[model samples]
Target chain A: MANRVAVIGIGQTHHRSKREDVSIAGLVREAAQRALDDAGCTWADIDAVVVGKAPDMFEGIMMPEHYLAAALGAVGKPMFRVHTAGSVGGSTALVAAHLVAAGLHQRVLTVAFEKQSDSDAMWALSVPQPFSAPLLAGAGGYFAPIIRAYMRRSGAPNDVGMRVAVKDRLQALKNPYAHLHLPDISMKMVEESVLLWDPLHYLESCPSSDGAAAMVLGSEQAATVAESATGRRPAWVHGMAMRSEPTMFAGRDQVNPQAGRDCAKDVYAQAGITNPRAELDCAEVYVPFSWYEPMWLENLGFAAQGEGWKLTESGATALDGGDIPWNCSGGVLSSNPIGASGMLRFLEAALQVRGMAGEHQVEGARKALGHAYGGGAQFFAMWIVGSERPN
Target chain B: MSKIPATRQGHRPVAIVGFSQNHSVRSDSTSNEVEMLLPVIHDVFDRAGLTKDEIGFICSGSTDYLIGGPFSFVTALDAIGVWPPKSESHVEMDGAWALYEAFVRLQEGDLDTALVYGFGKSSLGDLDEIFNLQLDPYTMAPLHPDLVSLAALQARAVIDQGLGTEEDFARIAARSRRDAMNNPFAQIKRDDDVATLMSEPYLVSPLRRHCLPPISDGASAIILAAGEKAFDYAEHPAWITGIDHRIETHAFGARNLAVSTSTAKAGAIAGVGEGHVDVAELLTPFAHQELIVKAALGLADSVSINPSGGPLSANPLMSGGLNRLGEAAQAILDGRATRTVAHATGGPLLQQNLVCVLEGA
Candidate 1:
């Protein structure tokens, strides 16, 4: 096996409902270029480009990496595309890093994007099959029943969800690239927001935005080279893990998915993390809905079983002063471009460890966790990035 | 090559320990993707003398556009009974790419085995129209040119370039179809005269019906084991000595229609520079593309090509490419050849290409 790889560069675009100015190819390029620039390299400096996007229905284009390959300067190099639903972004990055960790490519460019404006996500996701439950109401609807189950089981205060929404929106104010930046976001605004999925209000749900996220992953040798070239330390990859379970299976525990827990456990073990709640400085987790923040907190072992709501109830997850400042660069709830959302969180965590998160930088952060789950929480991907090089 | 720029990490050399495929057909549309993969999945595990519980990772590739639904991969999981959960992933591309990802992931040392599968049913919609979705929507889909016409454009360009004649293209179809006679999974076969093919009417102007790959409906699965573990599974493993893939521009105008840059680059990167190849399976849905790929990969004229008749005989859209890889590996497993190369191509005008070099061990 090869030595550990590091995340040397990261960049993301301002996610919005529609980036009308740029084409889909350009949208991805924007992030890729920024990542390369941050790494102090050009397209020629990269080895391969691994990308991921949601269903082609969103863009009405098939396997778009082929067309965009030249645009990304992947003409003479290996190029790949991955799709695992919402987790695609995280999975794409993980796959790219594996190439580096496995001693394949030195400087890999992995990007994930979605131009949701080109087509309706709801329609694309709701294309009814012969005998499947119609996703007529979009992703939030399918997840709401599970959310209700968590509410009933945990008996957490209703305020927990509202608090998470307010916190993430406030965090978005600090992130210039985040969508849904409410200058004066409050709990009332969230309460007054129209209800889409019952028990999940509009403000509580994630926004469907067009955006892209990119990262340049490197092996140990490339890491040293990048550090010397950019005058910046690399965020070493400590651990990564992914898991999936079939949807609609009998006794499929959607409320507290086993795959999610198992993935976190595996990553934590690999990272030598005995106590995620205290060992890690912060995390950037996929929480499209507010309640998911605490839910995932517990799932990731950041909090004890059924007691994650307490962490949210306390001011323990905020950037001002918290044991674990989650989503300091805003998260999936604040800005989402489906395919790229997970990678954005991942890249943000790397940024924090690299001390390049600008206004949302977590002070003295050394280790951070980036997490994302998709396919009705049946798919999970997470990585640990640290300030120090990992063996 | 020590200073070779833009290279990714190397994964543990993985081997094809076991494989199972459905009887290729033309009208498997009625059977859902999950249903088609059910027996095949079990058969692959049985062939490997293992169980799903032993497989470390499960990755699949297929296009949602083929099924006209988003998250097609999610629904297809029922076939494998992924209920207890497993390390899994899916790619929107062909299963060939999925194998690449799994091959790389196997480098983690934690996973000694991986399962990769792909399936597609092209009978639900008119294949020509459905394929348009593979093109850029705003610029290409709106124009709605079918694959046959697009391929004809390439075919015409290749002919104009004086690379191959229309007769040469017909011979490829004739030869592959005739060879496909013994392939139980092939969708079409014929030993008709090359002159007869030349006399046939054009499906698209300048391209005869025989030149096109028959629309196919099928699913395929292959088992991969890494390092020493591969020996425990198969007595003679088809070891993937080298594998690489690259992409070309999507805009037909930007890419050279007569040549496949991606294939050539991937071939060189995949160590086609190494020892001689005994057999080669080229994923050329169109007849002329076989010659194009053969030239790009620099395969020796003495090498046997697509002994399973190639994609010109049966094309399953998303899964076709991986089938090519499996076909070549089967040759190695059967001791028919000591070394072979398999190539898979995707996207319009052959925008994406993957090359896998398999060696018997």
Candidate 2:
């Protein structure tokens, strides 16, 4: 049997559009140092370091982990780099956890970041290639059609997207590190925002920010020591899973991807969760676009097919008094660093289970889920964390 | 700071069951990465007598800079035809690291088989300019130092320290090309003596043209199975007895380039010296790097090195390391050797290294 693993500490940067105050190395170090401090450990305690980011073209550097090894205290240690498009942050964390779960290491430090301010992410993603039609625009342009398809198939109200935009921005007000804290956010503000892509307004899309997220994952022995030293309970990892499919295939379901469903099923099976809506106290999911909130709801089995938007319209996902809160710490819609956005969702879930989310803590949260999808919605990664260890 | 054992308690035994590779060439102008990998993937499955549905997991290693586009690996997933959606992941490192990930996943006892692949087309872009991006962006990369100059610096260190001479470099290059003549997948095959190779003009100081690896475009795939599944796939599985990788400080000034300290550490952890090694395949893009890695691994003089000619004959950037591992496992599978060692390096002047010890069961 595999060894047990837990998240003993978590940290993230104060995401912003431009962090000119520090370099890329400084941005990642900011999160890593805080995570180390929170775990009540030093550099010597970490056995290995795992780094993740988007494409190298985002920062005009190829394999930045080789350069940042010193800053991350990885000298004379095993260092790994992971890149799986936007889901990289979550996958990077899973890779680190596996190192401990496989009985290979005691404590592992994992960090993911994206300094989009250094280079044009849109340009890097939209580079035209040979023998391919120039039908591609930005990510917004590519995903807009998928959102339109979801709307037509589900027959959801147009205002549903606008409502999600306003609700997440309001939640951002409670998160000190959120990049967009729109205190005056409302339905009117979202409706008035300019439409960048068809059916996607400026406010409905995620912001391009510079930030990072880090977590300290440890084996059972290491977790026991961390709890005694810090007097803080760790978030035990109940289950984790990742799935992928081809980017483009005939008859593929883009709106409700099978990969996301399969990944969710596998993780839920490991956690022994039958009814996610009743079992999970909260969730932090990747929703770069407002419509994705409802789309992922169905894909993740939180709601039945074609009825996920009803949950949003009924205020069931609201943080204040909702039955099952989602994105309690803002989420990707509020601050997206491209790479770190996924880890933020994962970190927020862990924070809720640990009762460490200061302002946005879901009351009495016993179990929570974190989700991330990337690469034309073809890759999915999800994990369930709980307050108590698994049997 | 405790020493990590070769195989930790409760760890599962994973073995290489099948392997295949495309013919190395200066440029694969007709095919993209997906097209190049399709045949290799199929060949690996066929050799192992398995189908795509049997693969429990899939992981790939590649970089987007070669294609000058983001999410290159995303489209390359077509090679596997993952219609039903499969458990998978990707690494930005070499295929060896991808195999490492699969190995760890198997230890969970949830997955029995995994397919690992790596591909690169070094001819697509200006490799010299592209490699500069790996340096410190704030310091070294701004100077635009090409990779050859960095390797030359390491070669100079080796010579000045009396570790080797120019003639030794020539002999190593000569032997590699001579050995490549028998390998159909090799890009460069020749029969040139050390004297003839030494007469060639230097590309960089102390480094001749023959010392550099061929700029080839290639792809490779390997199948790994755990427990009983390994025996069903191969007559004699090359069980991964030990595997470990380590990275050094990025700053070239802070490192002793003449010696591969990271390699030594990983080799020691992987138990490279625990028993006799019959054959070793070392990923030495530059001829002199072979000597450095061989010494770090402490392979005996009786151990055969690069019987498949190694990277000096055909080096594809991302796949070279995986190719070393495949070649080493091939020696064990073919019954030519019962035990073997494989070494793969990354970064300028060997800033990172991985070592794997395999034994036939």
**A1-391: candidate 1 lDDT, tens digit per residue:** 5568899888888888889999988999999889998888888989999999878888777778876887788887888889988888999999999888877778999999999998898888788775566768678988999999999999998889988899988888889999889988899999999988878889999999999999999888888888899899889999988899887688878888989988988998889999987889999999999899889988888888788899999979988777799999778889989999989988999998998888999888899999888878888899999999875
**DockQ result, candidate 1:** 0.69
The parts of candidate 1 lying over 4 Å away from their true place are: B1-11
Task: Estimate how well candidate 2 is docked, as a DockQ score.
Answer: 0.82
CAPRI rating of model 2: high
Against the true structure, what is every candidate's RMSD? Answer: 3.0, 2.4
| Residue B108 lDDT in candidate 2 | 84
* Candidate that scores best on DockQ: 2
Q: List candidate 2 stretches off by more than 4 Å.
A: B1-10
lDDT of each: 0.86, 0.91
